[model samples]
Target: MSELILGIESSCDETGVALVRTREAPGQVPELLAHALHSQIEMHQAYGGVVPELASRDHIRRVLPLTDAVLREAGVALDAVDVVAYTRGPGLAGALLVGAGVASAMAAALDRPTLGVHHLEGHLLSPFLSADPPQFPFVALLVSGGHTQLMRVDGVGRYALLGETIDDAAGEAFDKSAKLLGLGYPGGPALSRLAGEGDARAFKLPRPLLHSGDLDFSFAGLKTAVLTQAQRLGQALPERRADLAASTQAAIVEVLVKKTLAALAATGLQRVVVAGGVGANRLLREQLDAACAQRGVRVHYPELHLCTDNGAMIAMAAAMRLQGGLEQPRRDYAFDVKPRWSLEEISASIP
Candidate 1:
């Protein structure tokens, strides 16, 4: 039987809603009908970062409208939704609550069921939305918000953590380093843009844990190195900012690519799935493609737009999980969000 899933994502500074439909075949991937997202970047720019309270408020204002837009785009009515899915954790409490509350309320009104999705899992499985979806038994490099992890994935709800960041994550390295160079809000993208104009060899930045003989990452040190270099440039900082950005990006990319290859070697997996917001980095993608191609390995990624947190991934994850019988939806409207849940916990929770 086919089922329509309505997904809501409000884990951070974005309000996203998407509609997905389960395929008739048991093992087939679900179809993403439509998705809508409203980013709070512009709203939070003045603050240089997200204001939890403001993000929560904006979610409240955008969730319904976005949901409506998704439904309209999917050419479906609210009542036609068979299951309501939403991001449940590892995010701001207020932001998470907005999505959870909305999803639970909608499910309750329709007297259907609700499924709470792990934010990281949504990102991890996002590549399934792409044209070339990865098969099971792949190495997954997750580089989102404040997390950086390598996991061995065998199937839905089957995951083993191989290595992770001991301190700051890859995304943090980009944002923090960008801030040190006086780049405004949403530093990662800004830094990458400026990097295109400068020489990556103009400056030498540290690639922390690049030779630790393990996949564990430590970008906090890299961030510190960037700060030190910025301080040294003092008066010349503005003019040399692009070079610094390029160098910083190069260092981070090298570390990520090396660690990812190490992970693949450790697991002996021929395929890798790169997901999460930082997975959208152009340099990262280019380097990974080059590295993987040389080793006769396959690399997969979520569609550019789906690389970040979005309702499409949440819906896709929920649909896949349900299809795999890894989770059971509940009509019990009582719902809660996990602002600190880990993907390991999710793997362990499966019966």
Candidate 2:
């Protein structure tokens, strides 16, 4: 019988669960049987950023129902699940615990093995969930609220960090910039939407560190540039808001695309994969797509749903690890959360 893995993700504001069945034979892709996600956007809308305690509470409330829903949708008995996988780290500690606790307990009850999945690994591998996934040995740009990194992904579980943010991540820059413009919470998407109506040339924001000849990114300076421009305007000019948004978005996208290209060139990898929430930005996608097209480099991204935190990617990563014969969870093993986990620390054998 094919091994069935139950995946749970609660690294932040979303509670997700999924079931994936491995192929009967080796060297074949796993099939996603069911997937469910519950976003706490409305719950956190009042807060500018996520509240760890509230996020953990919400996950505890929704995870069980979501797991039930996914199992029912897949017509898979909980007892039949071969493994349980949960996001293990680099997220709000409290939130990570909620999922890890539940997954470990559930797996114990089912007498099945469990796996602790790295949150970023889930994001990096998400593109595989899409049709026409890129092959191994590609460059991955992981841009999100918490991280901005360039990685060399030779295969599953094998990731080499090429460059990363020295300060605020690109998505954090977007959110902060949007907040300065009076955009609501979860500002990245809101700001991107407003950017669509603005003139990209109107504000002329700085493209920080773009010419630094270093793979390291520094968005803090660019964010400061936006602040300086806003101050120069002397007030929130409602009419110019869109223009500012567009200009900021343009500068950010340019930096990202250029840095990714640099990474690709340095690594000599023709295939590039974009992951994380910021990867869903239309402008970034367009610019990267165009740039890659010009250079004969292929760019891959997860489908819109997989671009953000989700369980399918967690399950996929766990399945790959298990298949690769990585260490399995022991029943006596305790649940632990890594609030500051690093991607380079992930075991190399699974990738």
Candidate 3:
């Protein structure tokens, strides 16, 4: 039987809702029907960063409306949804509660079951929603918000961690480096945009643990290096901002590309999947694509829009998990959120 899954994602500053319909074939990916998102970027922009309390309140206002929009777009009534899924953890506690509360309440009111999804797992399996999806038995480079990890994925719900950031994740490195250059909030994208205008080789920055002999990553040192360089630039920092941005981006991308290549070499996997927000980076994609092409390896990425947190990935993950039999939705209506759940824990507990 085909199941219709309604996914709610309010793990952070964005409120997203999506509907997905499962395929009849066991291993086939689910189809994304409709998705809607409301970003708190504008609201948070005044503060220069996400404020948890305000984020939670805004999510409360947006989740239901976004859900309605998704249902309308999908041409399905709320009652038609077979299951309710939500991002259960690894986000701001209040933000997570809004999604969890709404999803559970809706499920209970409909007398349906609910599934709690891991935030990172939503990212890991996101590429399945892309036009060109990747097959299993591939290495995954997950670089989102505060988490950076490399994993081997054999199938849905089957994951093995290869390595991860010991200190700041790649995204943090980008944001922190951007701040050092006086770029505003959500610095990663800002920095990347400015990078296009300057020479990447204009300034030399540290590439931490580039040859660490393991897939584990460290960006704290690199971030500090950017700070030192920016401080040294002093009054010259204004004219050299673009150059610094480019340099920082280059350092981060180089480490990511080299580490990913190393992961492929270690696993002997011919395919690679890059998910999470960093996967949308133009330079990272270009570099990784060229390197993988030369090696005769295929690389897959989530659609640029799907690279960030969204309902589509959440819905897609829920549908895949249901189809894989890795989890069964619950009907008790009692729900909880994990502010710091690890993807490894999900893999460990499932099998």
Candidate 4:
């Protein structure tokens, strides 16, 4: 019989739940039986970013229904879940607690074990949920609102940090640039859309630290460059705004692509996986795809919807760990949240 795992994620504004079944095949990926996500984008839209207290409150209201929805959609009873997995750290403490508390309570009632998944690990392993997943030991570029990192992922529970941002993350740079150009909240996607219609050469934004000869990224300066250019425009004309957006996007994409290619060469890894929110950038994807094509390297990304926070990835990670015997069932509810958890600190064994 296959083991069934229930994954819960409420680390931020989204409340997600998923049920996955372990694959019996030696190398086959796990099966996602049912996946559900409740995004609080609308609720947080007025606030420009996630409001921690509001996010925590909403998760409390949505988690139970989301869990029930997933179980029903999967045609499985709560008692059928063999293991429960919850995201435990690197997020708002209040938001993290809602999912952790609920998951532990559910596991206790079901008499099953539970696992605490690292948020970034879920994002890094997300591409595996697809049909043509990359093999182990590849470079992972995690570009999100809170983090920008280059990591070497050897296998489950095996990750080495190559480099990371020293200041603003790539996603923050996007949003900040967009705000300067009069674009609203969640600026990355909005700016990318406008950029699609603008001239990439009309403006020349600086590609910060593109030739620094180091893996560390610095987007804070790049954002300042955008601000300076936007200030010169005075009235923020439509054409000027679009051009600024396009130029900024191009600059960011160039830096990311060049750095990733360099990382690939340094690590001798031909496979690259892009994870996190900014991984959804159209230009970034195109540039990486084109660059990798020329070098005969493969690039992978999460299904667009899964590019953001969701339970499917967390559940999948849990399933893999359990199948590999790296994690065992837990009958106790002693897990704590890590607001600033580091992926490198994760040991092979479940805590």
Q: Rate the local accuracy (lDDT) of all candidates.
A: 0.93, 0.90, 0.94, 0.89
The residue ranges of model 3 lying beyond 4 angstroms of the native Cα positions read: none
Per-residue error for 115 in candidate 2, Å, reads 0.6
Please give the clash total of every predicted structure, in order.
0, 3, 0, 1
What's the CA error at residue 272 for candidate 4, in Å?
A: 0.8
lDDT of 2: 0.90
lDDT digits (tens) for residues 235-348 of candidate 1: 999999999999999999999899999999888899999999999999999999999999999999999999888999999999999988899998889999999998999899
Candidate 4 residue-wise lDDT at 284: 94
TM-score of each: 0.99, 0.97, 0.99, 0.97
lDDT of 2 by residue, 79-178 (tens): 9999899999889889999999999999888888788999999899888789968888899999999999999988777889899999999999999999
Better of 1 and 4 by lDDT: 1
> Residues 1-351, candidate 4, lDDT per residue (tens digit)?
579999999999889999999988766788999999999988888988889999999999998898899999999998989999999988999999999999999888877888999999899999988777889879999999889999988888888888899999998999998888888777889999999888999987788888889888999999988888877888756658888889999998898999999899989999999999899888899989999999999999998989999999999989988777676767777778998999888843433
Summed over model 1, clashes come to 0
**Model 2 / residue 126 / CA error / Å:** 0.4
lDDT of 3 at 85: 98
lDDT of 4: 0.89
Instruction: Give the candidates in order of lDDT, highest first.
Output: 3, 1, 2, 4
